[model samples]
Target: MKISAAGPDVDMIRVDAERLHNMVSGHAFYSELPKDVRGKIGKRKAPHYLRSQEERNVASSINHDYYNSATMFLSQYVHTLPFALSQLSLTHAGDSGALQLVSMPLQYSMPFMAKAIAGIETLWPDMRLEMPEDVRNLADTWDLLAEQGVKGVGT
Candidate 1:
């Protein structure tokens, strides 16, 4: 992935997977886990372990150092694709052709958005998911219309 800026003041962007892994692994979020349990878990363990174990008990406790190290290594391998897709979506947000392609398929987009929201909730349960009041109003209106057997605008 590459990004170019308009001036000499803007340095070239570079992403080192190893460096990013090391940085993320060093963050307080990953570092604070108990070390003993991390060693027992396999490489294929779920990312929900990224969340603090204090929130919910796993069948076994994680080894903190192993969890952090393994998470760092795994994140290096796993995060690239989703990060690239997110960058692409942001880059294309203002392109009319791209917007039209995404917008023309509202049914598919709606479920995708819902799933993304659910994933966000799973990843950060304490975070609030906010939508504009107008969007909320529109959803309420659509639900009412659906209940009344009137498939009105944009349904």
Candidate 2:
């Protein structure tokens, strides 16, 4: 729980676990609850527009704090103009940097998978015991994948 930044910035502040815990404890605001009880902020009404400032701020804050914030209805990149212009994602050939219809050699997917495994292990210790046999087997395959040095797969 360390924050290190370089700048002459006067407003720069650092937060540790305890500080954050205090900030968001039982004292924190609840959207459903009245603003007075919830630290006296906004009005007690839903936004007229889906992309309103309040909506955007809440969406961004949730995405920042939570690890798995993906939802079917929401796009985190909706506010970014260039991202929409790029049409989600663009895959280019490695050699000539040519735009390829084929998405080849999914690079570093294994690292992300490993991180997902670690996240699950941390969040739910009994997950392996409760998991289905086939799912467990699939998870076990990661060890073999690591041994083979499949891109970004490592112990």
Q: Candidate 2's residue-wise lDDT over 65-90, tens digit each?
A: 12222221124344556743364456
lDDT scores in order: 0.46, 0.42
lDDT at residue 5 of model 2 (Cα atoms): 53
TM-score of 1: 0.22
lDDT of 1 by residue, 1-155 (tens): 24554665444322354455556556675545555334322232425454464333222222334334434534543576674356456656568667654443353234334444555766898895676999766655533332232233365
Off by over 4 Å in 2: 1-108, 126-129, 151-155
Candidate 1 segments exceeding 4 Å error: 1-102, 137-155
For model 1, what is the error of residue 60's alpha carbon versus the real structure, in angstroms, after optimal superposition? 26
Error of 1 at 81 (Å): 26
Displacement of residue 30 (Cα, Å) in model 2 is 42
> Local error of candidate 1 at 106, Å?
4.6
